[model samples]
Target: MNDEKFLKGKVALITGAGSGFGREMAKCFASKGADLVINDINMEGLEETRDIILKDHKVEIFLAKADISNSEEVNNMAKKVSEKFDNVFLLVNNAGIDSGLYASLKSKEDSYDKVMAVNVKGAWNVTKAFFRQMKRQRQFEPIRGKIINIASCAGTENGINPFFGVYSASKATLIAFTKLWALELGPSDITVNAISPGVFLTPLYKNDPKVIRLLLEARGVKLPIDKIGEAKWVADIALFLASPTANYITGQNLILDGGMTISINKL
Candidate 1:
């Protein structure tokens, strides 16, 4: 465990923080002593996350219930964050949706739109609203900001999975933006990166061993670790990117696929 309070005075804004990676990151950041601005469309989940964090950490946690897909809502939430904190040092665009197991021909257009709206445009909306503050902070801070976008292994051309073309494309878009923003923001000392995780035992998997086994067997997939990933694993990477440790890294997509992506047979 990192006992160093590296982010003691910094403020972090994380979207889709109600559960999964977002929730896990919130807990980790708070443990590192960073104040939090957590957002989610689901109020119950948001409150649950807040409760979990408050149990062990005393950092300030502000909850915002907003849909990241809605530009107006995102802007409004960002306004609240700006009002509460003078500057946001970290931004995590972790809110994303997956279009469940439907063939390309059978998938609904609305499904595609929903996935794109939250996964792609949602990330854009949050980043644009908070970037201004990050740029302004550069005038006085050594490192202005850090942005971590939660992408997926499915986004890579060679990492594509069956029946998830829309979700994959949406994540690919985010990956592109991660690199583009790193280029555009690097001059100002704002590092941007993406974490592309493969199979994780998140709520999506329901934490059922039978379901996981069935899915892996059905897809003929094999992982070197021989198990699904944990949300904490991804959160740990986000912490590294947001910390001063990754000062020189930028515009990179860090794949967390448990060696699945490197397998020729899986590819």
Candidate 2:
């Protein structure tokens, strides 16, 4: 029954904090008393996120504009974070991009590269930069800190999708990373976990009506959860894993799809 603000005094760094799960997670963590360091390419969106969070929590917040795919920028961001925050207890590698460049497109490789650059490489750069710092420092109990990676169930279950090869591959890689990093970082007590979100009504889904419709149709009649998931759902999961309660959890990917992934296939 330890309840004196789970995230109080902890510092959390989240990429893609300008929109979707990243933005919502920022607010959730702040509400629980965690200081924030958020990164995103959209300055306006980032500002909006900051404004919304400032309304309730009185915690330190740092907003940085940078593309996660840029190694230099990510490294620099990590350095700057180290300068400002004394205790960096959580890292959420949530900055990702989904290019609708299906395999049918002529320049599909180009699209795949772009998606991989952001979805996969970006995650790698940010994690490597931040984890290096965590590995050096000695702080909080059970686990020094936590890293929650946002992956997709598409990687594991729906590899047969018509044109989502690249996206699927990237997610598969993330899943593998979760397993590998858990083993590598277990010694230092730094837990690494992944969340494979099935269908969510975040900004990503908001962008394309056709895609949304397709997901709805694919789900069939009487959807599992009336509507798609909100960013808050993913955020809550991320916050839980980062909290002290999930200290014993690591190397596992929790699927959050409103029960979408567990359904029996019917065609």
Candidate 3:
């Protein structure tokens, strides 16, 4: 951990913090001295994440178990956070889901609705509920608020796999929102940005690494790094985006694809 503590005295809210990128980001933010408010639909997973953070970082952690897809639930969670912390300096919209391979085609309506609900609406609900507090914080305090959306590289790619169409569309929606929100909030000094990651070895593949490798290989996805990414890689980027260093960078989609986007010929 860096001793600089750039995020000292800040409060950060991370969605889908049960595991994967969100979990790692939570840990990274906590290490920098920010108090945390982490939420997930999975209570057990949320508890595990809280315990892990508590073990290493001494920052306060508030565990909220709420399904981000539900607007009412998300609004209530936001109220709770505001009541507890009064303001949140960092908001990481990291909750998302995807229909299993080929399932999007088989169950188009269900898959599309589910993916959109969690990925698109979930981000909207949380942001809408917290935007006022963020703006207020910017006005009264010296800190600037940040909203980091976790989009996917599939959103930017022109020719995506049909099996991932719904998932891709949802992420694309989020990327669009990131730009729009940045424009709307820039005047208030609230920076909004999106992160489009290519392939990261998170808990999603703990059970079947070979399957993921074959999927990427079949797509002719070759990166200069010649390896998949880690959750820590994404977490580090989140840390940078949330820190003061990223004050001037807004409305940009920072693609952390290990040069894969430029290396591979577009399909």
Candidate 4:
């Protein structure tokens, strides 16, 4: 961890902090001396994340348990934020669900609705909840708050991805929110962006290393990047976007697939 502590006096709210990108980003933000408001539907997972951070970093960690897909729960979390912090310096909407491999026609309507509820509508609710605090800070302080949406490459490209219809559609909707919200929040000095990751070796891949490699090879993803897309890489991009260097960058989806998307398109 860097000793500079660039975000020494800031507050970052990361949804889905129970695992995956949310966990990685929360750790990174805390290492930079930022207080954390971590949310997840699973209380146990959120506790694990909080414990992990507390062991290494001394920053304050608030466990916000809420189902982001539930608008009432999301609004309550926002109220909790108001009662605790004056402003939210960074909001990362990482609480999204994947519908695995399924064709649109074959998949049930409930599956589609569930995915949309978490990935698109859920993110909207969280962003709207935090936008007030971020905007209010802009009025009295020079807070250039940032919003990061964790979308997916399957959702980004125009080309069709086999068996990922509902999941892709949900993520595509999130990317759409990133662009539109960035525009709406720009004048208030809040930047909105997204990270579209493909082929990431997330915890979702529950298998041995060799077995995972064989699975990837069977699927034809023999990329030379060793690890195609690591969660840390996505976390790093989030940090950079939240930094002063990205003051002018907004409404853009930074693709973090390590050329998988490009090569597929070219080939």
Candidate 5:
């Protein structure tokens, strides 16, 4: 556990913060004394998340409701955030959607369109909207900032499953973007990375226990850690990346699948 107030006065922007990983990351960062700019399509959930955090942590919470899939909305959101905070030092692209279970080969065009719009283009939109702002912050600090893309193990063989082909491809593209953007942004001292997490009982899974069991079995029979993941597990890794300790780490995809990918690679 990190000591208190290590991230005091820092500003973090997290998208898809209504629940699950986004909410958990918000809480974790708040606990460390980071003011937040949280976004979600669900205003009620976002408000609730803000209230939950304010009760315990004295951190500023700025809520923005916008669809990340739309570039215009994301640009407007960037402008809105600029009014509250000078710059967003930490950005977590946590908003993504999965296109239900089906053979991706026969999946409808609409399905792919929606998934890519949110999972791939949505991330691109948010990053593009704030790239210059993050880069400009370099004038004050050697390290401009950190951009954490919430990719998935599904993008790799580690967590790939029978019906997640579309989501996997989208996440793979996200990983590629991470590498390319990191290379471009390196000159400005801005770090870009991806965290590929495995099976977790997020709201998507909690909504359907059967789906969780199916996903777990599809990923693997057993993981080295022999347990399911929680949002905090990924949040802890995000916390490390957001901190100055990760100043030298960029353009990398950190896997947090409890060795599930390694086990899969063995077979």
Candidate 6:
């Protein structure tokens, strides 16, 4: 609703923008006057997200239903984005999925591949595609670009999470990629960072029945956040990281766990 233009005249490409953090980030960026290219595999969800943002924010938005795991589709999405925006100032690799609870002994190859494809490989493809634009900008423009990746606290801690081992590992891989890319892009004035969210109640989580059971059984109860983290929190952080305000920061992971990770010892 805030029409103040921090990102005026900028362009952003966000993956997995159909729901949760991605959807919220799209709205936030639109509110700040940024044109958006939102990608997701969920066509219905993508349409709803597009409609919502289009209502209040008149910024140009393009939505595509592409699975990030498919390299060809991903590359095509990147091409479409580039054609629409010419150059992207903000690239957010935020599409991911939960593989449910699988024990180490019960982990299947399909499970590993599915999780890795979206969480790790998907991030890589998007980053690589956008980096080409960043590199190109390095020669002509100011090259002040940002890459914000979404990670999770599970990457750093292992507790009673069921079937989340693969998911955690995928997030850890993304964090690692963020660090390495930050190093590679910093000299060009491009910033790369990651965000690790705790328990945020979103459609992405609520839709997974098995994940809800795992949470209830593992912790026995939910924390007292009243409501889980809103998608807006993640969006706000993304805006900060992409803005000139965070120009000096790069290769850092901001854990937005809402005290959950901090209270692990007491629990």
Q: What are the models' TM-scores? A: 0.95, 0.91, 0.93, 0.92, 0.94, 0.89
Better of 2 and 5 by lDDT: 5
Write down the worst ten-residue block by lDDT for model 2: 156-165
Give me candidate 6's TM-score against the actual structure: 0.89
Q: Give one digit per residue, the lDDT tens place, for model 5 in 76-178.
A: 9999998878867889999999888776787899999999999999999999988888888854486887899999988875566556779888998899999
Candidate 4 on 69-150: residue-level lDDT in tens? Answer: 9999999988988898875799999988878778767778899889999999999999988887888775334546889999
Better of 4 and 6 by TM-score: 4
lDDT of 3 by residue, 20-97 (tens): 999999999988999999989998988898999999988989998899999999988988887799768999999888
Task: Give residue 230's error in model 5 in angstroms.
Answer: 0.7
How many Å off is the CA of 145 in candidate 1? Answer: 0.4
- The reply for model 1, stretches above 4 Å from the true place, is 1-3, 264-267
lDDT of 2 by residue, 1-267 (tens): 156578887889999999989999999898888999999999999999999999887998999888899999988888888888868889898988775635434436778788889988999898888887777558687778789999987666643243455777788888888888899998988999999887677778775656766865764623467566677889989988988888999999998876655552443
Better of 2 and 6 by lDDT: 2
Clashing pairs in 5: none
157, model 2: CA deviation in Å? 3.3
Error of 6 at 252 (Å): 0.7
How far is 196's C-alpha from truth in model 3 (Å)?
0.8
Query: What range of 10 consecutive residues in model 3 has the weakest lDDT sum?
Result: 156-165
Clashes of each: 0, 0, 0, 0, 0, 3
